[model samples]
Target: MRLGGRRKSTNIQDMRGSGSRNRGGFGRPTRRVRLPSGGRTMRSSGGGIGGIVLLVILFFVLRSCGIDPLQILAGGGAGSGFEQMLPQSQRQNPTPRATPRTDAQTEFVSRVLAETEDVWNGIFQANGRQYPEPVLVLFSSQVRSACGFASAASGPFYCPGDKKLYIDLNFFDELEQRFNAGGDFAQAYVIAHEVGHHIQNVIGVLPRFNQMRQRMSQAESNAMSIRVELQADCFAGIWGYYTEQKGLLSRGDLEEALNAATQIGDDTIQRRTQGYVVPESFNHGTSAQRREWFARGFESGKLEACDTFNNDV
Candidate 1:
């Protein structure tokens, strides 16, 4: 993406590399709390009711991300069916302490997130809704969150309980070198996806899902989750749509996001990690599914068109 002249968002909290050392042998402090089955919900509180709306939109998106909700309910991470593959110890807890980053990466991520804010805020206002900017927490190793502690190994995520997006800048290197999803737009996609979750939270989709999860069976729950995730992917595309319309996207930028989305699809990640595919357990959808949903939003650029739950997406 060509964000050269775009204004950076000030709604960022740079905590990269600044993790607590004395707490664990790994020298990483968990940024979030691990309360097991009943962890606190992340909330968007830095702003007012208008901002809260934006935060809620993202929160609901995080809940399912198109994962099998039943699998998650059976011991999977509510919003992280894929991430749960990693051991609990590997996740970071955001208890700010020691940081190993050189500070440059922190600025880079902050700037990118800031740019997302600019684009999203503009979009919300154009649609007659107030855009509540979410905070981006940059950390290294581990960090604590309102939801619980998370490790860098757990990857980047948006905590609905706190309405803050957590990211380890180093993950960018991993996305490129390890996952083959490189480029600035790939990085931007990750942020956009999380912001997409923020959008869901603001619109009350998350709370409803959480309630539904309580009443649904495992298979049914998973299906619901898939719907949620696919929608987030669509939402990301919506952001891309606006970015392109605003002339912020350069050639190949959208491709970078598509590459990222494809690379991280449930099918791809499952194949690489488990050596097989379990369609029922598939969360985040297949590479094709992800690409399609994102494209839908990017092309349509209409929120009404992003209703993955009701549509054939």
Candidate 2:
């Protein structure tokens, strides 16, 4: 990706070292699918909302390019789910303790956010809607969000309650080191995926899903969450499409992003962590599902092509 002269987003809040550490661990139902507690549904692509590689072709492609995808997959840390716990009564309203600071990684994230802002802002305007840029909150190991408290272990997420993105820069380090899914585009995919969640919130998809999820059974909710998560992946792909159009992508950028998607797929994570599969418990789609949706968006670059709800995800 060509990020040399890109403008970084100013809508950032730096709160590193400003709060107590989160002794909190991953919530129940794994660390990947903690829905918001207050029914503030977050939704996009068509309905709602990775780390490494699973394909042989990807393995060869990456290897031929001098990047061993498997080596990155061997690292331990791997969780890509956002948290949505604690009732509204227990939620804390966090105040920023520091202003934006442009370190190397943060600047990369900020510029990616800016790019998304450019694409979505234009897309929204074209659709006769206004795009309200979301804030990206950078924290230490732990941080408080309107949705709930999160640890870097649980990965980055967007909270609909506050309309802001919460992330620990360390998570990106983990994405590459621990998850073996290193690359600028991979990191961008992670950010774009979270931004996709914000898009759902903006388009009223999440709000509607939140209301409906209250009555949904555990299995039903899980099924619905898969759609939501896949949609976000597609939305990220849409951003990728636009980014490529601007001549930002290099030779292996798309594969790197797809590699990250497969690395963090629900099935792959389960296989690595538990040595078994639980199809019924999957909230995020499988590895192939994730790669396909992202490619679909990248190929079509159309919002309508990302309708994960009405079609097979």
Candidate 3:
């Protein structure tokens, strides 16, 4: 977590405060919905599976017309259901306004991204392959991606379609306040996890999973998703391992990441939100599972050891 004097990544797009406004409606009548603090009141196309599908179709139609679909879904709350359908992203919102503190947070994210680039580049070269670095898009309120339109509530995510990571930095605040997963390393874990997805995309794992999920039942697909997410957690742990080896990790850095993995586990989130845990519906693994997989990667630092698909998660 001690990133003092570290390099910041240049492959970052600062789209903060430049979000486009929602104008025309999709198909149905647009309704007004209140966003979190500093968020704009935008129009929604309605909620439900049918409504989301319709909005997606509309999104394509608008894209063909050279319009940004993010404008359409910004106020619609349609991104929630489609999160798992695509690659994983973080979702949470805090005040949208920029501040000096936010600048520091942005700097921290850039440095962490640089660290991942350094670690992964070396790993790929050692394996006789070149690493193609991914760009990270920093946005507030809403942003349009090749995967689809997303709101800040949709969280940080990596889109394989675009090979870029999208994040609303405010989610870091929510990570600390709502999930109780604070600290710089915890935030680094969040970025590293998404970068882990980028690794999956690079290694063809994500495409294979996407193809296989298409032929799976909902339950079966959810199971695959758990493996995919756990693998990403393991990849993040791999990054952590190298950081520790480089003497960059502080005393409690690993604990911060483990606590974060615990807090965001599907079981823990479901238990807190619904007062119960549904193992069948769990897609991101349990608290114990996440921590274990991360620990496994951190301990071994072997890509083979991080394989959650063939081995028991």
Candidate 4:
């Protein structure tokens, strides 16, 4: 990522270091369960019918609250993914909190966001649609979102309700240290992935999924979610396609991103957390699937090529 002279995006809102109590509790960071960090650090693999039943169960669980499970699951696993990525502790009572960030890292995130704005804006303009720039909320510990309260524990996510992407910069540290997926491009992939969710929301994919989930069986909904998440991965690759054409990617950047997609696959996360793999319970695709979809979008650079829903995985 040769972002030497790139400009920082002005859309970021810094809410670090501020804390307030809510009816549920005080603002606190999500409690991250410190999982051990030894693994292949390279690649891995994950399946089928019972998955649909699991999806239905999750939908009812989340719908009990105010969340539309399908919309939230549009990017990954049902509630569990949210729980693992963003802890329940922080969401209990979100308050404003900020931490000191290295100037270099913040600047790097801003540059990536700026590039996304330019690239997506261009794509939308070419299609005769206006691009709505999403604000990147940079917070530490905890922050509130339209989807609900969040903590860095949830990792980076886009809240469809609010149309904003929330990122805890510290997650990047974890990405580098634990996943061995370090690099500017890895970070960009995170941003682009979330922005990809925003794209889903803007195009009504998310809302439609929410509606369809109401009439679906658990397995059917989860299957739908797999497509949704894979599509977002493809969208991120599409963004990467444009960025690469703009000469921003350096030699190892794509490798870093590919490593990242594999590292965060549902199978890899499950194995890391529970010491076993459950294909039926899998939500996010396997590492190979993620890498393949992203590569498909990046190489083809055509929106029509990103039809993960139509392809049999």
Candidate 5:
């Protein structure tokens, strides 16, 4: 986490105060079409875990109203699943505001992103492929992404639809205070994990997963999601490996990242949220799995070592 003197990434969009004025409004203009060629929506299949849950609720609601679930999903209406499930009062299309002051936290995020860019670029080059850097969008409260509208409550996510990473800075506070996964390295791990998604997109892993998930059952898809998330966690560790090679990591930095991986495990979150565990609904992997994969990547620093798909993750 010794980030001093590290270069900051220029691929950043600051949209802190330029969010929506209404609960469901977009502060900025967004594309009404499907995601770009390389972009997919969210990570989970069937619109992601939240999306699936909402879809079920919505289906039941529509059915209760004597409406067809298929029609709503295919309604092409303003209140479609894509538009209705956002946090209330999320607005977009606000006037561009002045860039916020650069603080230590912001600088740290940028540096970490830059490091990922460097590490991934090298890795891709070694594989005879060029790396396309993804944009990182910093927002507050709520933001509209090519994937969908999301609030801080949604946590950090990568939008393949936009080839960008979306993060609400407040989530860092939540990670530290609520999740008790505080540390600069922990924060870096979060960013690197999303960047790992970008790597998956570049390598065509996400697209295939998205397609396969469409045909998968909820339990099956959630299992697939755990693999996807764990792979990203491993990728984050890969980045950590290179960072350590560069002598940028101090003692206990890796521990911070590992603790973060454990704290945010699906089991831990589920236990905290509902006071019970539901292994079937777990999208992200268990704490042990996450920690194990991360350690695997850091120890080996090999892409082949990070394959959570072909092997039991």
Candidate 6:
């Protein structure tokens, strides 16, 4: 990705090297050096389904908590997608411990965020609606938000309650080393996938899903989640569509994002870890499904193409 001279997003809340104890019991970063979540990295993928356009947005909503999502893809096994809504109180507003010094990687993430803002803001404005930008929280070992406590091991996740995406930059290192899915675009995909969840929240998809999921059985929720995550994947692709048009993408950028998506698919992770696949446990969809939805959004650049609920996925 050619992010040179791009504007960095001021919406970021830098909290690296900051740690605080929480009732969740996950305060210390050293004690819980997450496996590698860059690549649960609860990313999403796929096409089809109908109804709420925003319904396509929640597919990338919550990831499994503190489960090095990438390590699972690298062969840890028994994993879920990147939409984790930790059962923390949304009222908590813990103060920042400190703001660690920024670096090149931080600047990169901020620039990518700026790109998404430019894209989504224009999209929403075109439709006569204002796009509410979500705050991307840059935390280290642990941080607190309306969504509760998290560790870098939790990977990158969007909290609908708080409308903020949380990430530990170290997850990128894991993406490159553990999973071998490296590149700036791959990182952008992770951020965009989480932002997709925020899109769901803004458009009312996430609120509905969060309410409905409570009444659903575990299996039913998992099934519904596949659609949700895939839609988010499509949303990320939609963002990619605009990003590409802006001439920021290099030749291998799309593949880098797709490779990251494939590495985190439920089947790919399961096949590598357990030496078998359990279709029932699948929540994020297959590798092909993810790649397809992302491509669907990228190739078509239309929200209608991401309806994973009404059409065949």
All candidates: CA RMSD (Å): 9.7, 14.2, 14.9, 12.2, 11.8, 11.5
Candidate 3, run of 10 with poorest lDDT: 69-78
Candidate 5: how many backbone clashes?
16
Q: Name the TM-score of candidate 5.
A: 0.74
TM-score for candidate 1, please give it.
0.75
Please write out the lDDT profile of model 6 over residues 1-313, one tens digit for every residue. 9989886676777666533332122222221222222321111222222323444343334332211111111011111253222112211223333224236777788889978877777566445466777777778767676666665565677776667777777777766765567988988998988787777677666665665565556676677677777878988999998788767899999999999888878787666566788888777788899899988888876777777775677
Give a tens-digit lDDT track for model 2, residues 1-313: 9988986676677676644322121011111222222421111223111001112223234223432111000011111342221223422333332334326676788789878977776676444456788887777667777766665545677777877777877666667864578899999998898888887677655655665555656677677677777878998999998888878899999999999888878787777666778898777778899999999889877777676765667
* Prediction 1 global C-alpha lDDT: 0.64
Q: After aligning candidate 6 to the native by TM-score, how far in Å is the CA of 201 from where it should be? A: 0.7
For lDDT, the strongest prediction is 3
Give the higher-lDDT candidate: 1 or 3.
3
lDDT of 5 by residue, 124-238 (tens): 5444455788887788767787666666556677877777887766667767876789898988988988887787666655654555445556676566567777778887888
- Deviation in angstroms for 22 in model 6? 23
After TM-score superposition, the amount by which residue 277's alpha carbon in candidate 2 deviates from its true location, in angstroms, is 0.6
Residue range 114-210, candidate 4, lDDT tens digits = 7877766666654546667777777777777776776566667777776778777777777777667788898899888888777767766666567
Candidate 5 residues lying further than 4 Å off, grouped into runs, are 19-102
C-alpha RMSD of candidate 6: 11.5
lDDT by residue for model 3 (1-313), tens: 7889987776677777754322111111222231221321122112312322343344334324432111111121111111232223333345875577767887888889978887777676444456788777788887888777877777777888877787888888877887899999999988898888887777665654554444556676666667777878988888888888777899899999999989888878877666788898776778899899889878877676675755677
TM-score of each: 0.75, 0.75, 0.77, 0.76, 0.74, 0.76
> Any idea what lDDT model 6 has?
0.65
Query: Of the candidates numbered 1 and 3, which has the greater TM-score value?
Result: 3
lDDT score for residue 301 of model 4:
68
